[model samples]
Target: MLSRLRRFTLCSLALVPFAGPALAGDTSAWSAREGTAARLVAGGAQEGSHDGSLIGGVEIRLPEGLKTYWRYPGDSGVPPHFDWSGSRNVEAVEVLWPAPVRFDDGGSFSIGYKRDVVLPLRITPKDRSQPVDLKLNLDFAVCGKICQPANAALDLALPPGGIGAPSAALTQALASVPRPAELGARSEPGIAAAELHHASDGATIRIATHVGNAATADLFVEGPDEDWALPLPARETGADGRTIFVLPVDGIPKGADVTTARLRFTLVDGDRAIEVDTPLSAR
Candidate 1:
């Protein structure tokens, strides 16, 4: 057993030297508010590893009823982006997404987590023998009818040592990133678009027709900002609950094209969220 352990240690050490630096010189910590559209708090650091890899994750806290978007925010929202270009002794970093919840706004939709979310991270060391340091600049979006864009920088240090279990915070985050189910179920990518037309009276919009069906779904739009008013859209049901809807352009533009609005919806049968790239057309 002793001989085997030693051999394993040597092999691990060899892989360590080849590892790249993701966090080595700078170490700062950063966080975001819990209620904003991008209600995410993230931090990064270097930690002990067997083969030059560090275990880390971005911790996010979501307020009740609020949500943060995934890599693809669906129709109207923007996804968060992480940058570590300033760190030294770091070659690369990768993000591991936990399963997300389906977010619906009346008849529109998007995919994201509500309560809280923790994003997993993969860190590689630049030097196997030296303690590694990491710095991260994180950017992401949050929404509740209105959307918000946020950015922050964090620094962390990892001592040269053996790997250990994740922190309590990490454990909680893992719980939030739910596991996916039923791979055999055929479904669209779950992304849709919403185009809002701001007219004299009220806003009018349209959602992608590719969603499950009209009767079983509801529509919602994140107004023009990340924290604004988004009235629930009226649903028009058809045979088998599948129908196309055309809302009035009361307060939205009459002839606005696709770029002006964003739409999201949720299907009732399953908790699946569908997003639409809806564009406005003349009545």
Candidate 2:
């Protein structure tokens, strides 16, 4: 009878499933580097999303006095890169950048976020019925006295039903992204005009902006392509009571037509910012 009881106990134990590590939560474990650390946070399916899109974010934490670059790191800095090939059931992932503050790097001015930042991600699932597994390999730079490259590998899984609710951090990050605007927008903190002027030395782009405070307003310009390294715009007072920003056209790519090149302008004032894309034309 004792042998029979022992055999029955063994059978019952064999039938029971083995326990493993717990499933990941909405936020992934932090992947730490030298002066920075990063993680992935799932914001679940967006409410009332038309295309079944989901919201997520890459949160980067930096020590005091350290900073990370924007999509186009001004003057001299390396931008962050993301690789999501290892993910499953993901059709596309769009990274959105928040408005960054301008800071001095050595003697040159650079644009980036200090302390911490959450880059909002808009994700589309290949199979909405199945869970989406996200695998990211993020490579970014952190600068203080000097710049250094940092890498983090992060993963998170989102079920079809979602993580119960949206993430507030992601919501704020999304709101911080520059709103799209047209050239010559009349709104405050907007681009009023942009024109190319020719001088004996070379060509320069002059832009006029409307903002509450001229001292706190700034403008950043990007060429049609990444190869066109445009300089930061310098602020000046316009004769017509608008704030003017001027930049010399010194970094045009060879063989590229300056008159037809489409330029992107990011105008920032205080806590408000706007992005405008317009063609370059001589005044």
Report the C-alpha displacement of residue 84, candidate 1, in angstroms: 0.7
lDDT tens digits by residue: candidate 1, 77-182: 4566777787667777777665554577445555566766668777776775676555666665555555554555565665643135566666555544423322
- lDDT tens string, model 2, 111-143? 789868999888889878888888888877777
Cα deviation at 119, candidate 2, in Å, is 0.4
* TM-score of each predicted structure versus truth: 0.48, 0.88
lDDT of 1 at 57: 74
**Which regions of candidate 1 fall more than 4 Å away from where they truly are?**
1-50, 161-164, 172-283
Q: At residue 176, what lDDT does model 2 achieve?
A: 83
Residue 272 of candidate 1: its Cα lDDT? 46
Pairing residues by index, what is the TM-score of model 1? 0.48
